[model samples]
Target: MNALGLVVEYNPFHNGHFYHLAESKKETNADVVIAVMSGNFLQRGEPALISKWERTKMALHCGIDLVIELPYAFATQKANTFANGAVSILEALKCQSLCFGSELGEISSFLGANEFLHKSKQQYDELIKKQIKTGVSYPTALTNAFQELTNGKEILDLSLPNNILGFHYVKSIREQQAQMKPFTIQRTSAGYHEQNFVSPTIASATSIRKSIFSNEGDITNYVPSVTFQILNEYKMEKGLLHNWEQYFHLLKYSIMTMTEEDLLTIYEVEEGLENRIKKNILHAQSFQDFMERIKTKRYTWTRLQRLCTHILTKTTKQQMSFINDSQTAPYIRLLGMSSKGQEYLRSIKKQIELPIISKLATFRHPLLELDIKATNTYNMIFEEPLRSKLLKAEYATPPIRL
Candidate 1:
């Protein structure tokens, strides 16, 4: 009755993901798999290619025993917060271990890197700040600084998808002092960013999404048969987030009307990025364009998008500080679970420290309430048909018939 944990977005599950799940089961001999996944929006600050339910179905179809929603506050945030939220859920699930895909897939290398970063003192912090002052991007500066100590081998850069996320997971585990063990499965076939899908059962989600969007060919070759079957039940178009354009006026107005203090209240604002953001708000045409105009060496694209999402969600600096100072998340929201998962919940229900939320109607905490409001606003950005459908989206779909 061992249980393993996974933290994922599955934005759309593909072969590489399927491989990781199978490997996790084999390596751990676990009877149940629990995942804390992103909801409508992803960490990159972009909309998920599909709805969260679709992604959950995909995971359940591929052997996951339970799927929980990672709140938007963490999902559309930077690596640290995103990891903080996801890892918190996994720890609360009482998993014995966590398994994720990694490019190097060498656990020791990541551990060594994580340790070095942890031991960094004033000297290391100053070096990174100094490098960043020289106009190198934050990622580049951090990499260069770590290279000084490890001869370029100890630092994991976030610009690359998997490695960046892997480091965050490691860091979060250390921060929490959680008991779950960590493991990695080397990624194969298409790389995280690779656009082509040539592998028999290990294509990147990027390639699968491209194929699904273009209607060029059947994607069954890259995803599980169950995934293709569920996807076939509907016609999904690219940028299920197309209605995002409707927010243009709202964004423009909010930026223009907000005071300098208001801009500073947004999370991720630092060292006067607020002024630049405000300046670009009036001149830039679209969200992407505004982001480009304000982009700077100190701020990464994902960081900037997080700032935008923070502003869009009206998250203030005060709130960010509050959440950070708070050591634990308020609740773990359940997305879907199998009968075995239900049994696990019963086993851990009292032992688990955090509250588990399955419905939104009676949720009263301000932070939890904020998550609900954010999801409602997120639903408004979906196409007309999906708008209500997403709000009414139910959990506990019949267990994935694998």
Candidate 2:
């Protein structure tokens, strides 16, 4: 029952991830590792390089005992929401501890940062609003707000990407008044967007993905051999390795065709962004080009990209708002579980509040439906024999039991 939970994308589960999983368990002296992993889509507004099940299998093959999905609604949103959803899942699963990689690699500063933000919420809000009105990106505006409140502390800069997420996780845990204890493992290799490998054994997912897209044939060094073999098999079968750019035409077609009213209905579409996106779609050549043309100080690229994904996938504002307002994850859908994981689930089944979904046929919810849509959307990207075989029905693919 005292599991150490991880919030992960594992875009491709690499050696660095394996290290974190191992270290987190050791640090917490946890009995099991539970991961609330993002599904076919990720937090960065990019499609995952491989299917979620494959990534789940990767986690199980390595060390993680149980993999539960972070539903598409929360998995592909801003960091705060992403953290909220992941933490909620872990909490609902009755995890006793939450572990994540952090750039600052220390708990005190993160705890301090969270406390400061809470105490200075009003001041921070005013500063953020002022910065946003002056045409700064929300993230930069947030950093500015934190700086103003902290009286020019470099905590924001030092935390970087992962640490920022960790801060949000702690904040969310407090917001939920959840019992999960928190722990941090210092990130040991390349940073989130670092384009170079830190060592033969550790590389950023960004770099490994870059190598995959460029056909560099040098990625196996960073990822485990199981990963290497699985990726190769996926490539031959499903044309696996890809990024957001692969969906250029789909995004463009969706944007170019949707009415202003239609765009407004999509989640995160607001304040005449529909007009801006419509105006730019004709001349904008690729997904990257289109993103640049529409991106403004008021709207960050990732925010805009998530909106684009929402439009393409038909995730509506009403649906997302319903889930957000409920302040609860709709259900607990296991992705894959080892025998030990199964034992844990059996032990906790009656205590957990939400429905534990084993078959899609047995329960239906809009959020889970959205997840299936995201998966099927990615499934459409493949060609030939793999495309047909890779096609999955939400009901048909039962959680893998190892």
Candidate 3:
């Protein structure tokens, strides 16, 4: 069985995602579609609008054949680390190809960019470091360095969000010497961060989430019926959707009680950012306000949010040291699977390099422990029984078999 892999968040399975899934299958012509999805937290460092279980259901209900949890360690990281982890999982699963949606639809550009960067790595690193010294965000520095290196060349645009991720995906595949071929499809309609609906059916996940959060604009056309149903069911059961604003008080409390020295132990808390965060927490009203007060050219809002997520979950530098040492995830965590997915796993199970984890009790690793802590922290937003119920589900809930 040939499997095609996708690195996804599927925050809510929207029309755009549905289109991407379909196109990926068409492009790869693989027997099964596997998704390495973020768990309770996302790459942008925000708590998922719904739990990963719900999102898994959404993925299964859509076209995804198998849904595997991208562990909290990798899920909430920056682009390079996030892509490395996801691509590693796909390779370990013996996928024939990996497909991603990017603004630069052509796959050759990503391959060429990777080759160029590999050949000029030392020069590129020096350029990035020089650019970073100008107080620009790391992402900006990367884009500027790439443009300067390629000067007037039509290489992949590093500035676009999807393109950046695509470049990282290809780079990881090369670095790991994985056999999976990389593919890209042109993104349709909405942009990655577009918060307004630009199409009747195809909208960015950001816009879909914005619509749902504000309780304005109809999202019925933006997502599939199953996604709409699952979303409504989640809200009805949980009473409210998860968001940064909902956890602001808890985050502020976490910051208030911790000393600067204490925060320095948390991953990504460096260069006296702890003091900036501590100083701002006193006067900031909401999560957004705190972010605005603390954000500077050196740190992007997404970067700060990831740091806050680390602080909230108490993910320490020691706990995240595995990332610097290894690009691959230690295990493949199964979240849900369809019948076809089950057959594919059965066929490839013995050949897989990493342990396949289905139950929390059966797996014991610091990374997996962090995933549990993340789930616990995410569930803290709820009241009483629901909170306990969600936490218990982490262990008791088996992988969803469709």
Candidate 4:
């Protein structure tokens, strides 16, 4: 049984996502598709608008054979860690191939770029640091440095979401020497961060969420039927990230009460950003306003938000070190596996180098505890009271059958 793998957030399952899923199977010619998806918090450091189980059900109903949860810790991380977490899970599942969406559509080019990036990372790092020291923001500095090295060819358009992520996937697979073939499906008309629907048939998740929150035009064309069904059945409310001003007040209080040393402890609080963060906290009214005040050309808004999230969760240097140390994903944690996926797992169970975890109760490790806490935090974002009510939530959610 040829099995393919996908890593996703499915923040809300939409038509464009469906295309990627279907095309992944067709491109790989695989009988089973195993997905490693984010639990609740997405990569943007925002809470998911819907629940993970709802998203999982949508995936199972659509085309996926199995759906594993990408732990909240990794889901809300930077590109490398996010990709590492997802790729490691897929690799552990013994998948034959991995597929994802790409704006450029040329997976070959992405692979080439990945190789180049790795070989040149050291030089690139130095150049970027030099640029940053001269007062450019990190994002701009990195972009400029890459541009200088690539002669504006390969790194000119790193802003596209899929391209950036696709690069990470390639990097992870190469670093791990995983045996999965990597494939790409071209993204449709909608851009990943588009906040407004430009077309009737295509819209970004951002745009869809905006529509949902604002109670705008019909979103039926953009999302799949399964997703719509879940939205209706669950009576899912919109925008867990709705009140930016309220969150900003929390951040302001937290930053003001905390010391400089405390601010410096959070991940991504590098190069004395704490000073800027401390200053920005008082002036900002909304979350976006705070991000704007903190934004230098070096630090992107997304990066800042992730830093804030890290702070909110009180992620220490030790935990970050632990994540880096446990580089090779030690286990395949099955969320929901289908018959075909089970067969595939059985075939390679002996050859697999890592442990496969199904029951969290069996393994009482610190890492598992961290994972559970992250999930609970995610649940808090789901509905106000559900977060507390959903502690040890996975024990109740039975493995989905296909």
Question: TM-score per candidate, in order?
Answer: 0.86, 0.96, 0.99, 0.89
lDDT of 1 at 319: 68
Question: What local distance difference test score does each model get?
Answer: 0.74, 0.85, 0.93, 0.76
Question: What lDDT would candidate 2 get against the real structure?
Answer: 0.85
Q: How far is candidate 1 from the true structure (C-alpha RMSD, Å)?
A: 3.4
- In candidate 4, how many Å is residue 240 off? 6.6
- The model with the greater lDDT, 1 or 3, is 3
lDDT of 1 by residue, 169-214 (tens): 8888888998888888888888987777777767787777777666
Which runs of model 3 end up more than 4 angstroms from their true locations? none
Clashing pairs for predicted structure model 3, backbone only: none
RMSD of 2: 1.7
Model 4 ranges with Cα > 4 A deviation: 118-121, 154-156, 236-257, 282-285, 381-387
Per-residue accuracy of model 2 over 131-235 as CA lDDT, tens digit each = 888888778888877777788866645337887798889899999999998889998868888887768688889888888887775987898888988888877
Clashes of each: 0, 0, 0, 4
Relative to the true structure, candidate 1 reaches a TM of: 0.86
Score residue 122 of candidate 3 by CA lDDT: 100
Candidate 2 TM-score to native: 0.96
